[model samples]
Every structure is written in C-alpha cells, then in structure tokens.
Target: MQNEKRDQLVVSKKTYKKSNELINAMGKGTALSQKLFAIGMQNIKVDETNNVVATIYGTELRKMFKSSSGSLYEHIEALCDRQIKGATIFDWNLLMKDKENGKIEAHQVVTDASFKNGTLTLRYNNSLTDKIVNLQKDYTVLSLADTLSLKSVYSLRLYEMLKSAYDYQRAVTKMQGEMVFEYKLTELKLELGIINSGGSKEIKTELEKEFPDYDRIDELAEKTGQTKYKEYKIFNRNVLSKAKEELNKKTSLQVDYEPIKNGRKTEGIRFFVTKKDAEAVEKTAEVAVNKDEILDDLIDLMHDDFKLREIRELAELAEYDYDKIKKSYDYMNSYSSPVDVPIAFMKDCIKNEYYNNKTTKFRPKSSNSFNNFEQRNDYDFEELEKKLLDN
Candidate 1:
C-alpha cells in the first residue's frame, strides 16, 4: 500500500509538471499575449476587469491610487480609460474556457502603462494573451472559498486547543477539592519521606542527629522562649496534633469547612516543568503545548491560522483593495482563536463581515501619465456630513 501511494504521488508530480509545461508553452510569443487578452476580455464581460488588475498589482497599486483603494474594478476601468487609452478590453468567454481547463490561472493584472512595452499587460494569468482581458468571475468566488477553508481549519484547531486548556484547568481545580491542615501536613510528610527514603535515613532520628549542628533550629527555639530541646519538641507535637485532630474530625463528620484563615488563598498551583514534558501532554490534551525551546510557536500558529488565504485570493480576483484588505486583516486580528470567544464564533464573525460589506477602498488605477495622475477620493462627503450631523 505504501509503495502504491508513493507511486501515485510520483505520477501526480509528473502530471503537474506536464501541465505546467503545456501552460507555459501556451503563454509564449503572440500566442501568450493573445490568450491573456482573451481571458481579460472574459473578465471585462463579467465586469470583473478590476478584479484581474487587483490580482496582478495587489495592494501596491491600491496604495498608489488611494481614491479607489477598496474598489479594484473601478480602478481598472479608470486605468483603461486614462492609461491604456481604452485599447485593452476583456474577452470573458475565452478566459472562462481557459480557467475551466486549468490552462490559465488568474493571479493578478498589471495596469501600469509601462507594462509590456507601454501596452497594459495582464501580467500573471497563465492563459493566452487574447484571454488576458477576460476575467473569470466564478474563479474569484472559488478562490475566496478556498482561502476561507484553509483559514477555518487552522482557526478551529487552535480554538479547540485553547478550549481544552481552559477545561483542563477547571478539571484540575475540581480534583483538588480542599486543602486542610492535615492535608498540608500529609503533603509535607510525603515530601520529607521522599527526601529521607532517597538517603536511607530515618527522618526523626536524622533530624535529632542534625539538630545540634543547625544553629537556626537553636535560634528559632530561643526566639520562641523554649529553652530545652525536649520542651520545644513537646510544644511542636501538641500544636500539630491539635490541628490534625480538628481536620480529621471535620472530614469524618462530613462537615464542610474552609481551612484557610486570615490570608489570601490560591485557587490553583503553578509549577515549572521541562518543555519535553509539556509537549508530551499537549499532544494528547489539545492544548498549546510545546518544548520550551520553541516558545514562539503559539504566536506563529495563531497568526497563520487567522489570516485567511481566501481573502487575499478574493482581493486578487477583484483587483487588490488595500483598504478592504486592511479592514479585513484588522477584523481577523481582533478576534484571534486563542484570545477571542471561540473558533466557530471567530469564523462566523469574519465571514459575515467579509460577505456583507459592499464597498472596499483598496485598489487604485493609474492615470494616463504619471506626471498628470489625479488623486482618487475614497470618502463620500455627502454621506460623511449626514453621519456627522446625525451623531
């Protein structure tokens, strides 16, 4: 079975290489640009030329044309009118065929007048140049979905781990019921027993033997006004005995009692362990467990999980909208899987925000000449004035 699987993977790699070669061949010389132009025309037919540009130029162009920062389609239209002199137009049907066949993949569009020797070149589409102007609308949607799926999977995994951590802490608290004086004594005795057993010494005899050598013991007894060692022993025994008796009686009688008195009580215990040990537990428990050697793994994982690849893909399809992408990025960061409510909630929140919003300011189109480029406006002055007055 392993051998068969390996063989299948090898075959798949070969297929991919063959397909890539074919795609490359189809994109060379006149054939390349013509196919690209066809793809571009397809995009234009579906009113997605801006998306093509966004995929090509990305946020860099959006920043360059701030007025159309979130509207890649608008930027592309403007670029066609001003920079390209309306020479470039999308041929949608041809682009869709190329995309469906996997011969052409939409990456981004180049609205720069300097592209292809001063002709607006749709740079990264793998299809023929004639199809370059055509945009594949459905591909944009699918790309967004793919991006969302990857992000969702990562986010869900991280959220589950954090939830597990919270539950683990809760379980630990429940297991610890109550800590009475007797319990503390027992714990101390256990620790002492461990120390004594490891050295093959009887604890009481060893303490007595070491008593004369320890100046602190003598000083403590003196400060407490107990002169003789025998007297000090008796006093310690009586105090401990009374506390133990009270604790045992309370437990035996099934009486609920708080043993802590006059001091701040801790609800949990914190201790350090080797990184190897922590990771071992984390694997089984679904928590952010890692060897201390990689302290930053948690941060890196969370960052990767929340940043949806689909959002970027969608931006590519629509023409990169710097403002919209920035807003989406900010929203994603605000509700990270580790810190925010839950993974499910975070996914829903981002999806809702992304899908519902209609306008984004991120992609900007270049003007006819760099020297005479007009600054794009992003704000609706009338709407802003109304909102301000209402507030």
Candidate 2:
C-alpha cells in the first residue's frame, strides 16, 4: 500500500466533488493530508457571515484512515495537531494569469481548522471562498470506491488527473466506458507531482530572469537519479509505465498510452482509458432492461459465438425465455457481481441460475474481487507473452 493506503472516503456514503480550480491550488501534501482534505469536502455550509464552512466529524475522519498507515485514532490526533497548531499552514494559492496586465492575480485561501471532541470544522478565508465555491457547479466527483484501493500518492495523483480530465462524464447519453486524452508530457508530469508548475517559454524566461539561478536542482536530481524527466525514454520507463501498472492492477480503469511524436522525437502522451462497469465491480446498482426488446435484439447485443452459447446455456438452465435470459445478463452486469472472467463466471452463474431466477442476486463477496481477478488475468497474459517471445 505504498507507505500509505489509498484514501478511501469511508467517512460517509455521500460522494464529494470539488472544482478543478480548487484542487489545482492545493500545493504538495502527503496522501494522508489529501485524505483529510477529501473528508472535509463532504459537505459545505454557508455561515451567518456568508463564509463557506465544511465540517467533518472525528468518527468519520477516523473511518477515512481506518485501514491506512497507523491507528485511526492516532492519525486523527496527529492530523488535527498539524492542522490546528502547526506554524506553517498549507494555504491555498488560487492564481489567475492577467495577460493584459502582465501580472498574476493570486488569492490565498487560508484555512482555519479546529478539532474538538471528534469533530473538525473548517472556516475558509473569505477573500476567495466565494469564487472557489462558485466553481463547484463545474466539479469532478472522485470515485470513492476506486480510491480506497489506491496504494501510493503518485497513483492517487494520477488517478485524479485521469478522472478530472479524461474519464469524467461530459454528457448524459454517452457511454461511460472509455475515454482518450492527450496531455503534454510536462503537464502530465506536473499532474503526477513529478515537478513544480511550468508555463510558456516567455513566462519561463521572464521568471528565470526575475529569480536567482536554481538550475543546480537539476544537477542534484541527476546525481540522485531523479533525472527530472528530461529524457523521453526514461520518463516513459520510470513514470508512465509504473503508473499504468499500478492502476491497471489495482483500480477499475485500464490505462495505456501512445506517444505523441514530434517527427523524430516523443513530445506528449495520448492516453487510452477504459473504465470497468462500476455497477458490475461494486455489485450494487440496479438497472432496468427493456422488456419490449425481442430475443433477436438481445442476441445481437451478445454478438459472439461464445457469448451466444453462454446465453443459451443460461436460457436452458433457468428455463427462461430469451427475453428473460437477456434481463439476467443485464442484471448480472448491473445488480449481481462483476464479470472479470466473463466466460468462467458465466458458467458459474449458469450452474447457479436458479439462485438468480427471482430477479437479482449478490455473488460471493471478494473484497474488490474484480481487481483480484484482473491482476490474475494480467499475470497470465504476461506469461503468455513471454512464452510467445521465447518461441
């Protein structure tokens, strides 16, 4: 779990989504710090002074860290101490570029947090709270179920980047299964917390001229093997591959990338994302299928020989009409368990068809069992590749 487990938002069932603007302004922090911040975002309140406030109960806070680094109670105390009494507060630096004035408008959103008797109440600096709150309408909802399984800060950061940019839903009718996004390598690195922020050549030159030379940091990074991601090859090997491996292994999304080329050089990354059926992975949401659809239409949806056979087997076992069989598959995806190993799981479902004959059923609990099955399949695929290469 990387030194800290993924910040599973267990404090409440309510999912909290924050504006990208707010998320961007929060500078570097540990995974634990981020987990605490996420908890505070659960519910926002407006006070008598028109100020924005968010409260988190100590019990809920403890729940967020229950399976993480240390004892939940101890972590709660330590986090509260740092948040309340620490001299250097991690303040928000909400900034906007004023190209017309050749200046940057920075509004610092200072947090005044208090903890007493298992409750945390946060009061935001009034100067920019309104602006930040206004952007909430355009917020990204972080998937709590997925984040709980995340291991490292890097993976969490990458998860946020992909969720915010690519995988987020933009329309109501679109399939939420896959997303493709292209990001500049430098921007991608920044999103992963690999390095500090960067801007255009002119802005970099202007800032460089204004500030003292800090180029020695690059040399130090080279000596330390950090390498700064200056070389394309190393960036792909050290950063992109590692993130892809972790996400594909642990999370619901399948992540991959195609290099964007500048004629003979790699300049950016085009990421291909495929999200697992959340209903399937969680085995919890119910979706109604059309009873009007004829058997032929349902058969068309399962347009492969094996899938057709699987459907036929279920049809025969459950003594269900084709329309009924179709509903079973749909309900299995939405209300039953995930189908990572579809063929095998389908066979198992066929054997136990009567159990699901009434309407819906819960497959055996596997604790993110879908991910476990995914990891096994990936391992098997890798072994097959090695054998093919040897051949």
Candidate 3:
C-alpha cells in the first residue's frame, strides 16, 4: 500500500496506515514486565523462513541508556527477556482478509519469541509474512528511518498511535482539513504496552531485576491500587507526558493532547500533531526540527549529563557542527586517562578549536601565573620528547 499512489490507496473503516517508526517506537517503559519494548522491528520482513531476528548492539544502545561497561549487556539481555518472556504476548496481531468476500480476518502476530546468544528470534506458526498475509485488510509499509532514531520507548509508542490515528483520520476526512486523532484511555494504555498487571508474578519479578532504578513502579503501584500502572493519572505521568517531551525534542512531529470525557469522567485522548517543518516551528532553521535533533544526538554521545546552558555553550563553541563535536567526543573517549569532567573537557576542546584548527589561548585575568611552551623556559623539553618516544 505504501508503494501505491496516495490518491489510489484504499482505506478500510476499521484499519489504518502507520509509519514503521511509530510502530517500532510504541514500546514504553511504563508497560507491564517490559511492555515498552523497542527492538528495531522496522527490519522485520516476514517470509517463508517463519522467523524474524531483531538485533541491537550494546554500543548503539548506549546512546539511549546511561550504562556502565559490561553492565549494558546484562541489561540488554534482561530487556529481551522482559519483551518476550514466559506467558507474555503468547501471540501477535495476525489478521488476514477473505479476498473473495472482501472481509478481514485475524491471526497471531508471532507464535513465540526466544532470546539467546544476544539475539532475539520471533517465530511464526504459519507463513504469514507482510507480503502474503491477508489480515482483514492489506498492510501499509511506511518509511522506517524516523522511528529508528527515537530513544524513548514511550515516545516511539505515542508516535505510532498518533501517526496511525492521524493517517486513519486523514483518510476519513479525504486528506483535507485540520486533523486530530482520538483514542480511548484503555486503548491508549494498551498501545503503550501497559497491560493489566497480575498475569504472572513470578515472571514479573524476574523481569524487574533488569531495570534497577524502576522502584517508582512499585511506589505508584501501591498508590494506584493495582498493577500494570496503578491508574490513568499515574500512567500519564510515567508514560504519556514523558513520551510527549521526548517526541517534541527528538522527532519531526510536534505533539499536543487534550482529555475527553464521558459525562465528566475522563475517558480518552484527543491529540494534535503537526509537522514541525511545515508549521514554521519556533527558531526555524532550514529544517526547523533538525536543529534540536542534531543537538540531541550530540548530547546523547556525551559521557555525562550536561545542563542545557552548557550544551548550548558547547554548540556555540563547536560552531554548531555535528561532525566536529562527534569526532572530538570519540577522540576524548579513546584516552587512557579518563578526563575528570567530560562536558567540561568537550567545551574546552571546542573552544580551543583542537581538531586541526588552532585558536588563541584564553585565560582568566584572575590567574596569577601563565606559561607559553615556546616563550617560557620550560623544563627539559628535549627530555620530555625523549621520554614520550621511549614510552
């Protein structure tokens, strides 16, 4: 369907088109027992092999997670377990259509998934690749790059729901007029991978061990009086709002939402999404949203959390070139002696134009002593060079 002209496409009243990014990104941490699973599933090409292997290296994932050394591998393993563990999923959305009657049918998404040797393989009960499957309707294969760059599993999920709902809504409106997508709270929770808790306590315990800093889930569980996200308010706090923040910062779309009510009892979400590039988004650049995205990528590669002020300072100091910042960061990471402060070191590197370009050395007037390598009677320059060579 994605290959077809937009004007030639058909829209079912029940089915919709969703970018692969939104689908892959839809996993959020607020999900039950690792329901917020983002495994780079855009590469899933269903075929006769009846198997799909999704692999993400630890080094690439380090951009999303603040991890230390070998601990990341352990966490990745645990994440896989949480995503496809005992009594979880059981099956997937395997819907097919009856071509003769023009009716849609349903089938399992995947029979089961297993993780071993740092790779996850999802198996199918039958040969139901995207190319051959007849769900009640045909599937639309959209572009996948947008979702792959997303860091927050929550943001990814929201993007999926919003994009899905938007495309559906757009089709409903004949691709004209202001578009808004609506979803029930219960349905939204399901999309975010927050299933009702209490399915398998034993398995949940084993999965919780993977995420060490997730005690807030338990604290909220106590207050909300149920598991798998105590309630809607808590769900929004831990999942919805966080997703909103991440999507705004990292993606091309700008997301906003309002509450729906069933006689004053809140029931769902009515979300508004506009392409940042089209809307003349604040601080418009060649691509208005690209600015933040570039900054985000630069920030993600850093060794420590940097304040927004500091990040902006670094950006200015680096002449806002993404490549220069990355190369300097990679160089710094290769050091045998780790710098005491990473962001500071980065800022200093950029300010000095250390990567092939030299600049005047700036120092505080408050300093009492200053030395120039060439001008000063530096101690044993010949000896220092000899020692460096000796090593």
Q: How accurate locally, in lDDT, is each candidate? A: 0.28, 0.51, 0.47
Off by over 4 Å in 1: 1-181, 185-391
Per-residue CA lDDT of model 2 for 1-391, tens digit only, reads: 2221222222224455766655544234444445555666666777787767878785565444332112333434544454444322243334444436545344444456666776777776676565446564656777654454354556667777776665345454366667788876654554454544232343333323434233443334344444476788888787778878767755556788899998987767998887766554443211101111222244455544233334445545645456445554655566444455455444455566633565645454334555433332222322221211110
| Model 2 residue-pair collision total | 1
Ranked by lDDT, the better of candidates 1 and 2 is: 2
TM-score of each: 0.14, 0.53, 0.46
lDDT of 1 by residue, 1-391 (tens): 2443343233222210012122222111111122223223322322233333312233323221111223333434443443433223231111111433333222223333223322344433433333333333211111111111111111212122222333344455663322222222212222211111122223222233422222333334345443431232342354333433322221111112223222553221221111123343224222211111121222233333432233323334333434444444555465324322223333343445543443431222333454433244443333222211111
Residues 52-142 of candidate 3: C-alpha lDDT, one tens digit per residue: 4334444334332322234444433443353534333342342233346533334444455555564545554454444323334423333
The C-alpha RMSD of each candidate to the native structure, in angstroms, is 30.4, 15.7, 14.4
Model 1: weakest 10-residue lDDT segment is: 138-147
